[model samples]
Target chain A: MSTVERTPSQWRVYRSYHSPFDPCPPRTRYFNVPPNVLQPFQTSARKQFAPHEALRKGTLWPEYFSPYPPEARGGEAE
Target chain B: MKAIWIYEKKLQYPVRVSKCDPRLAKMLIEQYGGADGELSAALRYLNQRYSIPDKVIGLLTDIGTEEFAHLEMIATMVYKLTKDATPEQLRAAGLADHYVNHSHALFYHDAAGNPWTATYIQAKGDPIADLYEDIAAEEKARATYQWIIDNTDDPDIVDSLRFLREREVVHSLRFREAVEILKEYNHTKKVF
Candidate 1:
């Protein structure tokens, strides 16, 4: 005993004439995006690409491979 | 395929090893280069995504990318653990073999100093089979993290390891859901 309601006005029918084997896929109404929590990454990547390209290229991250401070070394025989 | 990538520039869990322990570092290297390690998990899923069904590719892609971040976390722990150890300390701790080859550097090798091999990962192009393998891979990684946690008394290191172990559980759940969705889709299509 189920009732069916019609909502044709809300539906947007899409047509794809290509065969199943076609390399291209039919476009959909929904576009997957980064979640709101991840929106910061999108903004950061945009900024990082601008002034930090050298850092991205590894040439500017000179401290990245620097050795740890001598005082931080703690494996002396007890 | 235009995609937006956001880089949250921080480690998911902080890695603070107060005392540099070369012995512990040697053991942690296994996670970086071990057969069932993060490197293997990342490559397996990333390579498989191209052939994955449209419905599940996103799951594989995101999980695979997260694995790369895990790999970085492990490498960071290893680096900090070996940071300032003397040759004598390293030799006594049984890490000299690795140091002789790489000189306090982080190399892609397991605990036994075996180099990472591409043979560690696989992509069968079948979503169900690959998802099953992914589940097993996550379990293997979680078990390894547990073993690390059990052996170490360092709370700082343990905290990071615990965080990583929890992530494995989450990934397994997501993969399970993806598998169920795939199965339902196939079933519905066959009927219609």
Candidate 2:
């Protein structure tokens, strides 16, 4: 006999209500604009914060979270 | 930066092998401490993090953490596969060498019983070089998983291996993206 096929446990869909504590609960922010809207101004649009700026702001961007502290250099430390 | 890890009380992929298979256990150990195993992957990414810039650091940290979880899963699979197995069974399956070393306990070693070593990975301070190495590591891991999948008949083991293999593919993609971001950062820095 072939290996028994077991169906994975079905997960219950939990609807997440926006937490009042969250000032921007996704979709609430206009950052993820549709490509059509973002494409035309993409070149001239206001540039987003640099990696360090995002880190200082505690932004969710991954680029800013270095596990190691930056080195003593004035430029972008390690 | 503050550490972002939250302990998940479960394996990302469940390993529920139905029967003890010592040979399978031995083979699975390669995924545990083999030259291209999860342990190496975790260490490689974690150690590589210090020199990486922002986004790449985050990616490495996250992927490295996930590799630890994968390491645990592999360890668990090896434990289950060898559980309660007799010396005769171990010998018959060519796992007597491992049994002699660890006595049915999970030890970090490859199928050939080579202990895990630090030399398996490199964190070369260059982000581009490290990311490329990360990508290659993931491919090697995916290949090992596929090889294990080919060798195993256990559905539970196969399913778990498949999940781990898919994760390697995803990690490769993320590392590739990190490489692109690093290149862009360097390009912009040069321009400015």
Give TM-scores for every candidate, taking all chains together and pairing residue i with residue i.
Answer: 0.67, 0.68
Task: For candidate 1, write residues B71-157 as lDDT tens digits.
Answer: 988989988877788889999889989878899888888888889998888788888998889878886886688678767888788
User: B49, model 1: CA deviation in Å?
Assistant: 0.3
Docking outcome class, model 2 = incorrect
Q: How many residue pairs clash per model?
A: 3, 2
Question: Chain A TM-score for each candidate, in the given order?
Answer: 0.18, 0.17
Residue A32 in model 2: shift from native, Å?
34
Q: Cα deviation in Å at residue B3, candidate 2?
A: 2.5
DockQ for every prediction shown: 0.02, 0.02
CA RMSD per model (angstroms) = 19.9, 18.0
Q: Which 10 consecutive residues of model 1 chain B have the lowest summed lDDT?
A: B183-192
Report the CA-based lDDT of candidate 2 relative to the real structure. 0.69
Candidate 1: residue B133 lDDT (0-100):
90
Q: Candidate 2 DockQ score?
A: 0.02
